[model samples]
Target: MNIVCIAWGSLLWKPGPLKLASGWHPGGPLLPLEFARDSDDSAELALVLCPGVPLVPTYWAYVDAPDLDTARAMLAAREKITPGHPESIGSIPAIDGAPVQQEIAAWLRGRRIDAAIWTALPPKFAGVGGRMPSAEEAVGLLSRLSGETRAAAEFYLRRTPPHIDTRYRRLVEARLGWRPLREAAVTCPA
Candidate 1:
């Protein structure tokens, strides 16, 4: 196949595909690329790539696709990105023709998968020099938030990997403390 869709987050596990893919690869860099960005649908923060930030351990998978347009359109729809923003889809340059999969791996090692999902939240994420709040700053932001916003941040933190950064984890846990909200009792509809 000459084209393939690269996945970094939830798309890694659950890819909403219109057609069955030919194959997939399990690739991980010692430090996965990650950046924090705002979400329109969930109304919370999302981990994406921000330019200039240190990368973290993460996974990216490549799915076989021979047709570029089909792969790009389907991946864009899956990401909920608006049409017309092909750059946001984050495909590598066409380069005349498809490069070998091994070459793709080399390119990914130095670049971040973080793309422009929601343009309103932050800037300088993709290249020209914008970056997300540092881990400490983000933790503080989460601490200040309440309700679903705070809860969502905590939930995502707990779910993601590279959590061994206890200092960062501690800040997030301490600032945006989380607890299960229990109902008065298990009251059933009569």
Candidate 2:
């Protein structure tokens, strides 16, 4: 059976126990992603766009396991990848129109049991929650913080609600005077 595992948060940049057990390296030339945090209250997450599925607001980390046991084992291994703290694993039941969830369900329909599981650190312990700052605020923060921190903040900001355009316009106008919005030629690496 085909299983697709999805994970957000710290696991995106850092290699959890699962990735390590699978003989995969978390940071290297291939993965250009980086994360940084200030205290335990806020953090920034970013990744270089890779081939295959685009890692959007919700990125799906796909893995095909033979059975639920194997999937659980992988998750367990992933939990131990780190030295001190361990990541959490859970099944992502059907909810919302999440493409990753739907894809896993579709795989299960044909196969006997296309079981899948996800792994990540707890929100509180991971310090993942932060209000979506205005574009101006984000820019200011980015300038002050390191590149890794800025990238993480931008990644979260992009996924945030209330619309990027609206927030950016409001903040830009308020901070840098009123000006018409124009599409600039900016090269963003995935």
Q: Estimate each model's TM-score.
A: 0.58, 0.35
Tens digits of per-residue lDDT, candidate 2, 1-190, equal 5444544333444544453223222211111111222224345422212223222333344454666556656766754533332224444442233223343344345534345565433222123442333344444644565566655555453432211223343453465343332331121234
Give the runs in model 1 whose Cα sits over 4 Å from its true position: 17-26, 29-32, 95-131, 163-190
In the range 59-146, model 1's lDDT, one tens digit per residue, is 4443444565666677767777676555565445442353323333554555554211111123322232345556676666566778
Any residue pairs clashing in model 1, and if so which?
31-56, 32-56, 32-57, 32-58, 35-48, 49-114, 124-130
Off by over 4 Å in 2: 8-64, 76-87, 92-113, 120-122, 125-144, 147-190
Candidate 2 structure, TM-score to reference: 0.35
What is the lDDT, from 0 to 100, of the residue 156 in candidate 2?
52
Show the lowest summed lDDT stretch of 10 residues, model 2: 25-34
Candidate 2, residue 51: Cα displacement in angstroms equals: 29
Candidate 1 lDDT at 90 equals 47
